[model samples]
Target: MLKAQQSTEMERLLMAWILLQNFDVQVSRFVDLISFLMADCRYQQMMKWIGNIHETLSQLFIDASPLDHTTCRMAL
Candidate 1:
């Protein structure tokens, strides 16, 4: 049951990231989602998934266009 709840929260966080235009909020929301997921004892085994998302976010900044580079880096 707890796993289901955490999964839902994580989904909501990702949706919030996608729907929201503010990069700062997206990063913060993801971080909070990761923190919450980490708090779950059973999900500690899934830490790699959280790490992957963080890595993806980092890559997203690097892949962004030059004009958005400063904006993305500043948000990170």
Candidate 2:
């Protein structure tokens, strides 16, 4: 009976160790996925900001063109 109890305990300990290893791997993968997602999110935000700046600059140039043409005409 004592040997049986020891065997059972050993099995339980082995199972616990396997579970802990698997849990560690799962946690590591989860952290890597989160880091990749965060980097991708930051990249998306930066692209969006760059797009907004480009649009603003384009609009400014569009708005200034007529004024530039009128000034050139007046000067001539």
**lDDT of each model, Cα atoms only?**
0.59, 0.43
Candidate 1 Cα errors over 4 Å, as ranges:
1-24, 58-76
lDDT of 2: 0.43
* lDDT leader: 1
Q: What is the C-alpha lDDT profile of model 2 across 12-74, one tens digit per residue? A: 445434533443334334334334333443347644654553354345435545335443223
Instruction: Judging by TM-score against the true structure, name the best candidate.
Output: 1
TM-score per prediction, in order, is 0.38, 0.31
TM-score for predicted model 2 compared with the true structure:
0.31
Report each candidate's C-alpha RMSD, comma-separated, in the order given.
5.9, 26.1
For model 1, how does the per-residue alpha-carbon lDDT over 1-76 read when each residue is reduced to its tens digit?
Answer: 9779888867755664563345545455555655665554255546666666656665675677634646565655
Clashing residue pairs in all predictions, respectively, total 0, 0
